[model samples]
Target: MNTIHFTNLPDDLPVAENEEQKKQELEFLKSAFQTFNETTRHLQESYDKLQERLNALDLELEAKNLELEKNLQEKERVKNYLNNILESLTTGVIVVDKNTRITTFNKTAGIILGMTAGQCLNQPLADTGIQPLAELVQSSGGQTRMEDHEITTRDQRQVHIRLSASPVQDPAGHRMGTVLILQDITQLKRLEEEAQRNQRLRAMGEMAAGIAHEIRNPLGGIELFASMLKKDLAQDPEKRPLTEHIISGVKNMDRIISSLLLFAKSPEPSRQQCNLNHLLKDIVNASADFQCPDNVKIHHDLAVGEAVAAGDEELLRQVFLNFIRNAVQAMPDGGSLRLTTQTGNTADSRSHITVTVADTGVGIAAQDQKNIFNPFFSTKDKGTGLGLAIAHNIIKAHQGTIDVESETGQGTKFIIKIPAWDEN
Candidate 1:
């Protein structure tokens, strides 16, 4: 192999003019080739470094994509779990966008409003046809929290509902939308009204007790004087008849006063472990004097198990007697009076004995059911309206509960539950 050396080139060689010029050009070409080789070597090294950097970036991008996928899956799972919880909740929940369009509605909200989520979503409140709710939200001015609003449904059924709405915002405080929560409070409202009624009845009972006591002594003396006056006027037949009528009327008023006194004076319960079945039998026998119409048949289903309760025997008897009397009155034409006893456990797992008095009679109207226990509130003209009221008070004093269920013309059932004493 022949290698060209730059230093070996002749500076001035004797030759023809053309030959000398060619030699100079050849030497310059050799020098330029050496500089080109050095440039190529530098570029090859830079290309190798760039390829390594590109490979590193590619691997980093793959890792980042995998991490993003994992985060997305986690977020999806969390969203589904939260959605399931919201759907299962009993309280109704609805979310609306800033434009008043429905964004989300849970299953409970759908059921409560009598519409499906698909029908409600993305629709304006007005278009949904819930007029009361739409008007309320429109009046809220983007936010409202209302408690215990009474509303009637399309079916004309009254309901007490609580509403709460708050504006939803993003983390940076940007207005997003609104969230509404709804809760049914009809039963709670009824309970509050019942408590107030019971308070008033209690006050009345106390006052009646004082008045009856003061009037009873005078009434007894008057009855005695009237009887004596009638006996003295016996010789005068016309006068005797008039005096006897007065005596009889006065006696009837005195009897009513005595009964009022007995009701107002709540005797201390002589509590003992007593069989409720026996007590119920006694009540049935005593109620016969009320002259229940012939069409009314009485049936008893006493539990074979321990039908035991710790309460005053006489008071409990009176309670059942009052209930039976009411049932008889409800069915003027007569109906079936079925008495049943069952032993069960309470929600808290405490043992209880339940006595039920059911009647096939003209059932109480739903509107009047809530106030049935209020004193002086009665459906019957002949009733003083104190029977059921006093019965309720007696049951309450016994640490028991009396619940009634009735539908108009269907029937009425009263369940009295009393806790069983500890079997110590």
Candidate 2:
């Protein structure tokens, strides 16, 4: 407004200053670009390192997972394998933890103890209701391990058992629990006793046979003389009874001697297919011959199927006749008699023919039962006492077993098992 001047005024303005300002702005932009490039490079390097670390962790985790699964599978396989071995043992096996809790109970153990796994497993052994086993384990007077120890069951069956106990230990040898092994030996004991009895009887039989022969010679002469005397006294009626008494006494003595000889004899049984049902029926029908009373009732349950025995028919007839006669004699006051026949399996699962004779009568005493098969051990007031002994010997010869069960007043049962007739 006051009259402007043209052209170059001051060197500090416009051209030179503009050039310097542009130079400074270019330098600052360059410095800022370099700083941004360095920051981006550092960020990229850190991301690469983080990615590598994550990938390494995933691989380690995968391997660890595979090993864990493999260990789980191995453990399961071992558990099942152990379970199978525990189940198949015939001897009774019972395992209890340190806390006295039942951990394992096998099938044979269940059978012998008369209990099931559901009733015993995880329970206290003392509370499982097997008192004899518990007493043998827990009682101070009892032994933890013993052989051929005898005990009575709740069902009143006497059992012989061989038992052993051992400690269960962990892999580290720490006491974990106790394991008990048991075996039932009642049959073996009975067999041994029978063998001993047979040996004694054999010796007695040899002596009795000799004595019987000696007596028989004199007995025959006595009977012959009595008969002659009876003939001479036939006309004298007063002396007839005296000669009759002598003859009667001689006849009785002869009968006893015959019985003694019969008991002493043990012939090997002649085997034949004898239908036990038919044989028993015949004996029952002819029970009158054995003096079966009119007041006594007889019941028969013969098997519908064939119940055949492998023994001599004549011997079987005699054995059954003895049984029926003894049964009739036992029930003097009139009671029931039951005869049954069945084809079945024995304890070891062998085929057998069972003949049961049960009578409601005055039963034999428990003490007397132990000696009932011994010769000259009579239950009757007037008997030779050789019937049962002879019957026992005959059964043994026939490869059969005879057992008697009796109580003082309850009743008596005779069980006879013979080998079933096998064509093979």
Candidate 3:
């Protein structure tokens, strides 16, 4: 255990050394404080600038989001408006995918096709089983338009359609689908056929009139000479029979000339409102008394109570009488004759009177039907064939229509439609 002892020094000894050490220690503390305060101020300023920049970015983002939302709403509204327009169109529109499956079908398309959109949707064209549309699509070759194409429906009704097809494509020019437009032209086609028929009849009437005039001059002399010869042969029984035959031939020729004259000179209709049912009944009564065969029974079925039409009385009477006589003559082996009258509206919504004379006899052939109304065209083994030609002209002058429907071994029906008079 060693111990050492030290003596205490005076307070005033080595003052410079002590003062220098205290000054160095105080300066070090001041420098550290200044550095700490400067660092704290810089950190606070940096944090404030970062927060301001963040707030500005948030406002810009909100503006962009609002603009985007507005654009989306505008696009949605445009899409709805286009859809409405498409649905309102009268012409049929059909859209198909690349695989030939129907994608869109408008209301008119459904009506024209006789199928619903739901039934056709997402189904292949061949699967839809519409032969006309399928054939059209195949012939279209995905690029061309076909116009005025005629097709018969499932129910055997004929239709005229104008079709146009175009291929749908993406921005990259790849075909996406096909769009088809169909327009109905059935009524237009009917009107055209009527005009053509009328023209042909007019030409034939003119030609028949000229021929009749040429034959009449010689026919008058033949009739006069035959009558003189008949009087001379009154003394001879055998010669009298030959002269009678000559007279009968002259009378037949005169009747043919009269028929040709009637066909060529189309009289203007003096239209008056008349009871069509009563007129038809009178015609039937007259026919039964004289023209109609005793074996052919007549049936009157007037469904309409007040069947009336605007027409010339004399001309219409002739038309009805001719129809009845033809119907009675058709039934050589004793068939029934049905005369039906009714009031109905036409396709254009016009009220009209309709008369149908049907006969249960051997029907007319299809090839002969087309020429039945033409002058000098007849199947009957008789005198001239001008009865129907005259009848057609009379009906046409009265703004009426007469058509025939017949099938082999079935029966024959003649339909007459005349416009009704609006007394009001």
Candidate achieving the largest lDDT = 2
Give the per-residue lDDT of model 1 (tens digit) for 48-133: 88889989998999999999999999999999999999999999998888787999899988766667888888999667766656
Question: Which has the higher lDDT value, candidate number 1 or candidate number 2?
Answer: 2
The residue pairs in collision within model 3 are none
Q: What is the C-alpha lDDT of each candidate?
A: 0.80, 0.82, 0.81
For residues 1-424, write the lDDT of model 2, one tens digit per residue: 1222233334565887878866766776676667777777888898989989989989999999999999999999998888788778789899888776899989877776667889889999888655655655554232246545776654566668777767777999887777778788888988898889899889888899999899989888988888898898889999889978887888888888887788888867899999998998887776455656798999989988899999988888878888888888888899999999988898888889989999998999977987889888997888778888889989888888998998877789999999999998
The 10-residue segment of model 3 with minimum total lDDT is 1-10
TM-score of 2: 0.74
Model 3 TM-score relative to the real fold: 0.72
Q: What lDDT is obtained when candidate 1 is compared to the true structure? A: 0.80
Per-model TM values vs. the true structure:
0.74, 0.74, 0.72
Better model by lDDT: candidate 1 vs candidate 3: 3
